[model samples]
Target: MDRYVSVKDIEQAALSLLPKGARDYYKSGATDEQTLAENKLAFQRLRIRPKCLVGVERCDLRTRALGSEVSMPVGISPTAMQRMAHPEGELANARAAQEAGTIFTLSTIATSSIEEVAKAAPTATKWFQLYIYNDREVTRNLVRRAEIAGFKAIALTVDTPLFGIRRADVRNKFTLPPHLRLANFDGHLSTKIQSTDGGSGLNKYVENLFDKSLTWDEVKWLKSITSLPIIAKGVLRGDDAVKAIEAGCSAILVSNHGARQLDGVPASIEALPEIVEAVKGYNVEVYLDGGVLTGTDVFKAIALGAKMVFVGRPALWGLTVGGQAGVKRMLDIFRTELEYTLQIAGTPTIADITRDMVRHESAYSKL
Candidate 1:
């Protein structure tokens, strides 16, 4: 922790420490990985136009997401099989988010059960990330369990009709270790992944178990089944965002499934502006989560109209490096950097960050 000064350092450390299979599974994106690289590159293309001598003194990073007050505008996004990164897994992530006064989302395919996370971090603001299963009962059961466990919302993933072609997983024959099971499911569904399956076992799992013919009706169905707010995750287009809202989604997560579901889609940041414009005048909140690595990235997304931004891999990197402590450190890093950004950028609070403060690098060329 003392030696690692940045998220990249932590990521490199985790990659060095993790086994080849788990390492590739966590790092690799879809075929060609064009969107994967673009998520970060897009952020770099945006420049912050800082204000000078605005009498900056204190900077506040507090904000609200999904009706809950958070310490900062950054939250944890769901990533599967976190136990591969650390022994404490989702439990550690929940605890870290709790301590940071932020939100933690548990993946549908998590290594820890919904009940386990609730009991472990009883006060954490938790959301359950869900996928509609081919068996409606399975999906229903997961939602019911999440609601019963005190999860605050349902982040319904709508992007992965089929898993993308991650070449790394295919070559590594990535499968969950024998010791860990998908804690939310029972029987074969819990431990379905096998190295003998030839290609990526997780890909095959989604192909066989997840619903492919889902429509906007499923969003209504999800709302019907639970009183929890439905956050439509993986929306990239304004039309889709509008459709999600019309179908009763309470929020839109502007994402391309972390560039894991498709090879050549817009980065979450790049897709954000259109969705924001489309959702204007709606009560629903919009969030982004594909590639957020630093404080400036968070500021840029907020300026572009994301109510909040989330990090998936950065949290994993923290968990891998030092479990709960590592995750907390990672969050602290973001919080501190964001505070500096707020003060230096002449915005003393989250609300002060506006679209005018961020400019595309191309904007300078015309001048």
Candidate 2:
């Protein structure tokens, strides 16, 4: 509705619109959902130390990622089976991102094919999120297709060697509705995701198709195969961030798979500073996702050294509510809030968002 001014409002609308099974599959995290709750909560725990008496008339949110100029530091993270939420699915999402001048990452399991999304938003800056399937040829073909279709980068998701145990999906026996298939696979591979008697069909699909033995060497191989920059998503630990750089990754996405693949991992925000510190000398850039729902969250993320902050569920929520226009509204809200935040914090430009602008609440509580 037009009254929906915030992401939470859109999220409520989406939850109300989607079926129980699809809603839960989209919203629920891994076993226990501890990290899931913590992801957002951690942002609340971070206190912003705003400055005063500084002229903040103009605020610029534009930033560059992987050499592409985006209107803002906030971008869309890849989420699967979007048609379950909206008819246009990834196509709408891509168009929305293009309209907002931000990057749109399409999931490997997206309901729309690479060529379809490319055709839908030819000028959009897109990154293809890759799940290294067991079949190397299949994975290579996906990369080749993305490059051919003009996707700028490859975001290799490393956390999901196997799918997480989401109880909601298990209880609902989540499977793609009979009508929807993984459009990316279409004729190139089996589009069918077999329904399971119990548990999520997705978990079974991932378990059977994903390469469990994936290693850093695989990252090297990915670089060798494609000229597009590779971004290693799901990196939390500082050591792992360093290793990703060593593996020839151009960027590191500090994520916990939206807390979907693990029960108790540090929130992406909490893990960001250390990763930023670890990658100091390296040329790699760091981005963050998981629990970035507001412009304040984006501001905090940039202050904490993330070049950009991504939102997965929020984008889906927007898509569910009103297709491309809804997604555009969601991004506009973030941009507006972030501008207000920058004005209040005395930071006029993205580069002005320094570490002193934010502090962990715990640091203050200790005193």
Clashing pairs in 1: none
* Model 1 C-alpha lDDT per residue in residues 14-55, reported as the tens digit of each score: 888888898889988999999999999999999999999997
TM values, all candidates = 0.99, 0.98
lDDT of 2 by residue, 280-346 (tens): 9999889999999888999999999999999999999999999999999999999999999999989
- The true-structure Cα RMSD of candidate 2 reads 1.1
Positional deviation of 81 in candidate 1, in angstroms?
0.4
**Candidate 2: regions farther than 4 A off:** 187-190
TM-score computed on alpha carbons, candidate 2: 0.98
What is the C-alpha local distance difference test score of candidate 2? 0.93
